[model samples]
Target: MTYPRSLLRAAVLAGMTVVVLVQFAAQLVLMVPGVLLGMVFLLPPPIHAGRVLVSRWRRMFANWTGRTVPVPYEPPPPPPEPDEEGLYRHESTLYKSPRFPAFFHRLDWLMKDPATKRDLSWAFWFPVLGLLPLALAAGPLLLALWTWVWGPPWGLPGEPSSGAWWATAWTALWERPAWLAALSVPGLVALPWTVGAVARWSAWLLAPGVRRPPSAKRVEQTLLAWVRCAMLVACAAAEVVLLAVSLACFGLGFGLGLVFLIPVANSHFRWLANMRRQFAEWGGVRIPRPYTPQLRPELRPDGLYRVKNNLYKTETMATFNANWQWTWNDIASWRDLVWLAADPVVTVALVGAPVAAVVYGGWGLVFPWVWTELFDADWSAWYGAVAGHRTLGLLVGLALVAAGLAVPRPLLVAHAWWTALLLRPTKAAAAEAALRERVERLTQTRTDALDAQAAEVRRIERDLHDGAQARLIAVGLTLGAIERLMDTDPAAARKLVAQARETSATALTELRDLVRGIHPPVLSERGLGDAVRALALDTAAEVNVAGELPGRPPAPVESAAYFAVSELLANATRHGGAERIGIDLRHRDGVLRITVTDDGDGGANPSRGTGLRGIERRLGTFDGTLTIHSPPGGPTVATLELPCALSSPKTSTS
Candidate 1:
């Protein structure tokens, strides 16, 4: 059986996280120097540097949880402008002279920021909170490994009996040490749940979004309930047939029949359920599993009684006990037998007819000739030897040939409809399944958002490293050369200085462009509406704009919305093939809606290119929706809606 992906994720993440946790503990050592710097020198560069390292830790936490954390520290106020002589003096003065007021201000701002504290808290507690699930997922595999390698030679911890041979350990599991094989079953089942759960817990703490659309979720649940119904019916029908076989075998084979009645019936029921689940899945329905919570071994009366009885309790014997009620409770398995028995008879024909046609129609013609030639027998002997000699032999052969040519596509269609009838889930199950799917989707998009942010940061870094930073270094080198040449070659010094100035100016412009590419300054300074209007000013097409939110959204949402519009406008300009475009923005009832319409060639689809899909995926992170309505030969309209309220005490500006 395949393990659930959640368990695999939990196991892997937990292992890496354990190492992160150790590093996380080590990070607290930063506080010692941080406080030391805070007390002595107010404007300490080390303190800020330490925080930057901690921000990386915070990002790791966010990634595991599938939530993106925006860096909270404000960008340092722009450096003082140059004087008329083109000299920058404020950088020297801000830190050099007299009072430590600037230092105090910097320290105070770092200490006061809420985001800083959130990061610190997350670093310390995430390991504690996340480790339990991780352990659960990883524990079974570890135990199995121990048993497989060591338990065969020597029994576990206290057992005195010599362990079984390695050959019998797994294959002939019933003879000795069968529990080793048994251990693997629970291990596979335990691990797959933690992936989404960890993600949800992380999101809740970091950046919880809105609930899924109830209507859509409810429909999914309904579909799941129907699948359960199908499986139940199949299980019941299959069980009935198996039950009769079980009794018949028991009557004939006696004690040896124990294997038939239990294993045979169970295997058949399991197979039916598995098939139903697959069929339902093929029809785009997720079967809702019946949730069962187990009683803890330590707290359960059965465990306590066994302990009190010195582990010699005969009544605790698991098998060879009468428990018809236990069997009766397996409603799901039995219910599936019914569906299995009724599983669209047409499905068998749908699958079988073509196979028959291939087997006989393709291979049929040669069989008779081969038999006749090899044995030196005539057709009459091959056909009439089995049935008394008659003129009907040729007709029988023709009928057999005709049967192979049958193609029953209608049966295939009927089988599909039959599958659809049973696999649809109920409202509640659909809602629950929808939530699971949404959680998985939210986690994915959150990861994408984080990745996008990281990519942007890297782009900015590269621009500085290769472009602006390199330019600045060149300028500094030129300045040093000019300084040395000033007394010796005045004209050469002036010419070099002028080139350095130009280099500095170019680097500054590149820096500004990098910043704008990340999050436009216009979007922050003037709200999304005006920011978009500013964007349109540079576009080639004629554009009209309307509507505005009363206040700004969270920084991340605003940034995503701005880019979403930008992407749409770009698509319109490049591929839209139109002269005019319209933009509308409206915020009401805690949702921001943006509509972009272009009088262009209509047939626009996300599948045709990455741009539209990229916009949709970006908006999806904020519990947002993107709808595109474009028909051939006309106008195209795209609408984006995000579920976020504009109620922050201070408007967020990125």
Candidate 2:
């Protein structure tokens, strides 16, 4: 009962094509049934039930193909989540516009083609005439096949291969009235078979288990569907007749009929195709797969056969039939189209001078008398001889014509360039948009990072000032009091002194721990180079630091660079599985560049950890940055750049 969408589509297209061919052989009268059959057969199923039927059909197909072939239907992609404003945004224009929906709905109605009222027989007459030529073109292939299978004459080449003798006898009969009335047996058979095929197709289309009628709830729905289809067929038939009459009446001017035929015929065919595909889909028939679109022109020459090949070359035709018309929505695509249109105009202008010269030169030689008559010039004197042949005049005339043709190229090119410029997006607008997005992102990141860092600093400062500092002050006061009491009461002083010693030791340890927490003493004493060396030495890493500053930089700059380098080295050793590290430092023109590179398992993402972010934030204060380059394999490089005065330390304190 139900068909695959593709199968229905194919049947509809195939049937429409066959009907069109029949019309081409016959006349407009035949096109009515063709249209009716196309619409009735191709009509898609209604919504809810249609979806259920399609799903069931798909499963059935999957099973039939032994699961090798995939289900025919591809579920629509999930819709985008609603934004903060609660407005839903769809990706396609079809979802957004009612006009497209209405257009397609009208097409569906035209395709359904229910019979509410019958059209006058004359209405179908013209379509038959229009389809006649196309049918004739296709007739030979079928006729040849029939002749080969059945001994109906029109036999195979070289000798009477089956039906040759019978065809000859029938041809002889066609010359007489009785024989003509009887007709060639082969012709009669083929004609009846074709017609019967069409009628069967139309009847099958009208039957149930195929396209169902529109819902009965809407009073005018069924009637309207029928009327719309009738109107469409009538229009198509009338157009065909009008075109024929135009050709008959005006002769050469009949070419203009295509203007009417192109739009209407294409729409008709499209409607027919959709219906066939839909019905076949409902009826579980498999349609041929669609081709991908061609993004570029093919390499073949643009001759008739080549063009035909290109048109049918799956992808190329797909691209042509697709919605690729250059629209103003996307500025880049529109601009390219503008430039393409403009280029010919520009070339024509620049080509004019040379073309004019050639034309003039050639014309002067052939028509010298005309030049004299038209311009009141003496051609004999132009030859510059006593018996002049107007050679000079001829040269000038030819030059003038050549110049006239040559002058237009540049003008045309300029015009074309101007037109393209008009279509092109303004750089200012694009730049402004980029700047806005950049600023917005940067502001959000900077604000969050700063807020986090400030909270951390306040917590550290409070710990040091309140807890450690207070304990140290208490210990100092106790020791001072014990010193004063030692002279006055030796025993009491001794006891006080012991207690003071215990307090002093505890306070001293706490102070040292706090100071270490604030900033490593090793870093200050030995400088960044030694701190890194100490880290590598302790961690058992093969660390190499080349181009270490011979002297320390400004304290803030040195501290920032040292910490940044230390963090990278630590990360590389811990996570990178790095066997070796190479560190480089250079100072030039008030800028310090430090690079720590490692040969390790790479693919390190800075966003995944705070180590890199901390390094970045520290460098931010001094207008510096840390850049990480880690791809999917080994060898990662971390570069830290800071604006500072670079110098070698004269003394080593650590």
Candidate 3:
């Protein structure tokens, strides 16, 4: 049953081969005219049609083979959207109508997609390669039919056979039964194998992502490295021209006293240097920009702007002068000039030499052999012939190309090192940058801390007004009512007094609860470790407390750490579905460290939860840090560290 089904599927695939051939032909016919006539809109339709056809084939193949083939194309770009001015934007151009922009975008999508090329290649090759399996599947069946119709063993009754070449050949085969059986048996045996082969062939090109073999990946990386080397060489040549322009600008600006050109040259060409700095990452080095912060002119009390000792009525002039001074005084600006001058020389030596060797060796020495051999041209000094020997030139060219391929990656690293030598910030500049970053972080954390404090104050005020203060006012009103009722009705006044007493007790409880929120008494007296143990007793999950501190941390640090741990435990129980949790606290080297580990469904992220972010802000006020490591499964570990000195332990007095 399986054999018959396999043979039938193979036969169906063979029939589908004709459809593939027609589609391939139609694509070529459409593509040539589109290419010649500059009608790009004509190109995408046929390619799109071919993609649809191949996609069906991919689905059929997957179903028969029981192996999935994912779609390889990137998602199509969204339609052009109107900007704030109500004009549609595509690339840099603003369009009044989206029609042309949409058309061009679709054309670019079809042309640039890698799957378009793969689909076209598959269409052309599938029809050609499908022939072998077609024969394996349908050949034996056709032979048997021919024998049944024209030969003696199973000849059709009263049927006249013509003397065509194919008919006579089948007649001869039927007479020799052994020859006929030998031909039919193998194709029948190999039918299932043919189906497997077709499935494998389709998957080879149709699978998504990095399904290509490792050898192909290596070849791709090598080619990309060579291309990068060539690009670096080209950039080197461009830098040489820029260097010459910079020299001219410097000479004219300083020598002729036309000083405006100095800033103009520096500001205009600084982007090229920055681009190289970014590109250095390809060679495994990071070169940060070394320029100092831009300086701004200060506004004076007299409504004039001050740049140095000069005051100007208008801000624009003062700003220009400030920028000029800033650029002029920066040491990095001079380093930029030095790099522009030195880079062309260094790049040409390290990167350009090998690239040029490959280009000249391949095109000059090896490739010209085609002209020499086919066109019978003269082989002389004009075309990289060595001592007029094309053979020797070919060998040397091969050697040079091999040497070029072997050295590009190493030389790229060397060039990056040279770039870093001049482009990276000096030690003093690095320190200044670090200081600036630290100041910015401190400013942000200060804002967060102040905001949190204000919110806490508001919360405390609301609790007092709505809960304790209101309850106390009710108690005072009840006492006044009891005093009024004392003379008229003694029993009613006694009941009122009892009600007032109960109300006062409830108000006192509310006040105590509010005070506990402000500062837990357990944390103040017994310290953080015991406070956490008391917290654990209230939590639903089983909580284990371990480790001990030699002495208590500062009151503020202890409060923040306790709240952080409390939040973690609440999250573990409520959101994490945790069954067990552990808390460890220890002080080492003036740093209070607490780690909370939970056995839960773990994917804890600080960015996703306000509780975690609040904890971070609270800790940041004390220059502490929180680190969370929670993978997808169980066991989330959150570590909190605060740098502070511990005070002496408080003695317990009974």
Candidate 4:
């Protein structure tokens, strides 16, 4: 799914505003540090590094502020590329953001200010120093209030007749109405000062001419800016609402969200924050998700699983075909089963004698008489010693309980590890599914192309025999009659000749139309470049083509490409209501990429449109693939990729 640049900008700006507001508000209490920590993990390495520098300086400033405020900062390391995988250092929940480094860096740059420095020391220590009293008093004052209100007299704790003098004294001292007033005073002053400093920094950071507009201009722009901000805020709100709904759904059903729900939620929040900051900086906004966040887990045995049953069962094409999904069974292969067994630790534990001992001890304790009868010991004495009010026995009993709980953890972990190890091959089967999918896609595309060609051939043959050819045959018959009649009667021969000419013209026109529909003759004579231009010129919508083609391609290749463009444009004009279209064709690294983009009412569904289906079919003949990028918006792009060398078009001029 994709969003329009304008609405996307607005959504981003709104998110930035929210992040800033939340950060500032949290600073008033000590919640800012956690949020900052979360943000730091969300941001890119460079911005995080810059923030670290700022943080250190802020701590220095805090020391001068005559207050102790630990301006904390932790710089994240450089990010891994998109495809790299594995757990992160620190076992950080922050790592959950699949695109963390990229996402956060964009956000940090958007949210950063020169006024705060790279470390953000000033922002941190300033808040800490300014709100030190409020921060320090928060815990004790709450405790004092709790005691004063729900003191011993109000509860059944020692049943005190009245509130303690000390409790009242402490409450009066720390929880005074004046302190609340004092707490608010710093915020009022700090708000404007911080805002101004940040604003000045922002003005300096942007290009010289890119200053915030003057009062009059601001007033004029306020409405639009507000609208943008509102839209972006709505996007953030939508994210939160969707997250909650998804969580609720997960909880109600199989609880797929349980294993990684918190992490997913955190990652999503970070993503939204990053998105918002970028938008806000650019004076843009983002909109709520047009499509639902439907992330079904890809089946993997070792990785997180969606369901328990899918573990043992193999994957089948039928499993995926029903829902257009590739299931665990379909991808699961015998080769991966060996890795599965080797990876799981279950066998090792089951063979160990220590595990058996622990299990026997627990079972024997449940019915001590059985052990006593077997051992010929005094069960009652042993039970009394443990249960009686005695020092050694009581301690021993507690130790036994502690040991019972403690011993199980490592053993359970080992068991799970072994089980998972045994299941490694199954997991490998799931992981290899992507490779299988790539192969299948190639095969399917080629099959589709063959089918399309067969259909096209049948169509052409039908048109020729039933239409132009039959008409031409009649013309030939008329000419033959005219030739014979010419010797007998010249006037009659002239009349027959005129009738043959009319039939000849009609047949010629029909043949021309049929040829044009089959594969435009111009495409074969000129090449893809001129063919596309011609096709675009015929369309009502504006077309902008970019990229240079090197020499002419094979006839079959050019024709297939031309037909694809024609079909896409046809669809755009007939159903899309698109005003403008962009066609980009490029040959890079020995592969041909054809991209067709349109700005119109989006939400184009491939399943519902034959034009797109035909494009897919055509590309399939060459083992090429079509990818649709359409959301409910004003723009959509359809991309076609083909292996130039592997797929040569098949056709017969005859």
In terms of TM-score, which candidate is strongest? 3
Error of 4 at 436 (Å): 6.4
Residue range 69-150, candidate 4, lDDT tens digits = 4433212223432311242222223354446444544444335433334223334433433333333324344444555565
**Residue by residue across 236-340, what tens digits does model 2's lDDT show?**
344444444434433432455433333232222233223323323322343321212223433345432233234534555544433232111334433333433
Please list all clashing residue pairs in model 3, or write none if there are none.
none
Candidate 4 regions off by >4 Å?
A: 1-446, 480-496, 645-654
Selected candidate, larger lDDT, 2 vs 3: 3
Q: How many backbone clashes does candidate 2 have?
A: 68
Worst 10 residues of 1 by lDDT: 290-299
Encode model 3's per-residue lDDT on 113-229: one tens digit a residue.
Answer: 677778877787887667666586566557656665665444522222544455566556666545665675777788788877877788667765436789888877777777888
How does model 3 score by TM-score?
Answer: 0.61
Candidate 1 per-residue lDDT over residues 1-654, each given as its tens digit: 135556656665677567657656565565655577654453245446646655665575577555675555533322233332333332223334223433444454566545455545555676775675655645545555665666533442342232334433433443344454465565456544555565555544443222447986876655444344444345445646755665564465455645435434433455545555565554455565432121111223554323222332344432212222233344444444455455535344344554444344334434554454334345645443235432344345455445533433333344445654544444654676678788899898998688666766777788889999899899989989998999999999999988998999999999999889988898887778888999889889998998877888888899999999999888888877768999999998888999999998666655444567668778988889899987554589999999998854344554
TM-score of each: 0.41, 0.32, 0.61, 0.37
Prediction 4 TM-score vs. true: 0.37
After superposition on all CA atoms, what RMSD does each candidate show versus the true structure? 28.3, 27.6, 12.3, 23.1
Task: Point out where model 1 deviates above 4 Å.
Answer: 1-432, 631-634, 648-654
Model 3 segments more than 4 A misplaced: 1-238, 251-258, 275-288, 351-416, 484-506, 541-548, 572-590, 596-609, 628-637, 649-654
Worst 10 residues of 2 by lDDT: 114-123
The local distance difference test score of each candidate is 0.60, 0.50, 0.81, 0.51
Of 3 and 4, which scores higher on TM-score? Answer: 3
Give candidate 2's error at residue 203 in angstroms.
60
